[model samples]
Target: MTYVLTFLPWIVYAVLPSAHWQWAALAGLVVAVGVIVRQRAAGYRPDALIIECGSAVFFAALAALAFADPDSSLHPYSGALSSGVLALIAGVSLAIRRPFTLGIAKQSTPPQIWDHPVFVRTNTVVTALWTLAFAVTAAVLAVLAHAGQGHSTAATLVQIAGFVAPMLFTKRYVAAVQARSVPQ
Candidate 1:
């Protein structure tokens, strides 16, 4: 669910034609608010608050741009701008020592293991990988957008790989560490 929410804005922007790109910010704002409300209603804090905040900020900026300069040329670069915002959010989370994954991991992990060195280290590494993926995705998307090919096949593949790579790595890395921790 969190993953879907995190990717909602990107999905929206990608699906819509270029002319509707500016509306992606509105779509993102709606999804972010829905996620926040649903999580709070269920008595569970959302695991991806950083993502939600980033979306909110992006939406606000877009709204301001629309209001201030209705003819601004930011619509074409919506994909790259969105990716850049996500990368910034992930990078900032790492810098603050509160890897965004830490919150998601805590939801499933036992409280006793929350402060364990292994757990902390695992999440840190996972978060680092996520940050790197976002950064690379942003760079690639930026280039594509600059070339007026943001919706090209290469851009789509890069976006898919960006999310899938870290997801697969996290699962495999966690399982391997867990297997090793179990003694004969």
Candidate 2:
């Protein structure tokens, strides 16, 4: 069920090149909000605030772009990237919790930190920073689009290009702070 919403945008991109990206982006939002609610309802207090914050920033940035131009420059890629940023944080956190590698850390307290707030803020900041990058990328694309150049049609391609270093760096840093020792 979730997988459909997760990859549908990409699938849509491949099959229907002429489709409006905003529609797929809206669909992705609906799916993400629904999943977040479901997860919260299931007693999974898995840092919803940070996710919400990141989502808000990402959306706000898109809204900025949308305000720039309703007809031409309002690309779905911004909103999609916004949604994707939170999705990546959530997905990575879940993967760490389940039957996966680094399971022991899911169980250790860091001696360097007193509470989760530090890393929670770190994750939030990381996501927000990425969201800013998303905005910059959007601006670049918009300019190029106005100039009649570049692949602005590609959904969040700029983000994927710029996201790796920050994501990996933040992940490793936060994991160091929050990972628990496995109870043997």
Candidate 3:
């Protein structure tokens, strides 16, 4: 559930009316910064705040563009851009051999298992799933934006599913792995 909080800013940005994108972007930036500050106060390290950091950078730039030119041509493709940036962040985390999920998972998991192959493998797979979902969502959103349906019901559903599907997968995958590790 805590992991979902990382996406709160994006959700805020998405649900806002397109005409209010400048505000939405600014809101996202504020929320992202807030989440990071809260987490830091709670003793979370930079590794655990990877997504939050990325969100802050993305939203900062987005907010600047949104306010500087409220009528910017890129506004319509904001959803795709957001998802693509997420994909890049997640992909970079994997490339560095530090799955973004790994840091979060460690919060709930025992320290003894942090270095276990199973734990690491599970995080890797889960991170890969998120990367794939974000990539697909970005592509579909790009196409929809091009077709003038970027803010349509279908686009909203796609965005929701993009986050939800990976979340559900993470829960089930972790449970299954735990179940398999238990002695008969």
Against the true structure, what is every candidate's RMSD? 2.1, 8.9, 0.8
**In terms of lDDT, which candidate is strongest?**
3
Q: Which has the higher lDDT value, candidate number 2 or candidate number 3?
A: 3
Candidate 2 yields a Cα-based lDDT of 0.43
- Model 1: per-residue lDDT, tens digit, 3-122? 666566666656655555456556666767676666567555555466766776777677567556655677656667777777888889889998888877776788899899989899
Candidate 2 residue pairs that clash: 105-180, 107-180, 107-181, 108-179, 108-180, 108-181
Model 3: per-residue lDDT, tens digit, 1-184? 7776789889999998988999999999999999999988987778888899999999999999999999998988999999999999999999999999998888777899999999999999999999999999999999999999988999999999999999999999999999999999
Candidate 3 RMSD to the real structure? 0.8
Flag regions of model 2 displaced more than 4 Å: 1-18, 46-73, 76-128, 149-156, 175-184
Each prediction's TM-score against the native? 0.87, 0.46, 0.98
Superior candidate under lDDT, 1 versus 2:
1
**Model 3 bad stretches (over 4 Å):** none
TM-score of 1: 0.87
Write down the lDDT of every candidate, Cα atoms only.
0.75, 0.43, 0.93
Best by TM-score: 3
Residue 74 deviation, candidate 2, in Å? 2.7
- What ranking emerges by lDDT with the best candidate at the front? 3, 1, 2
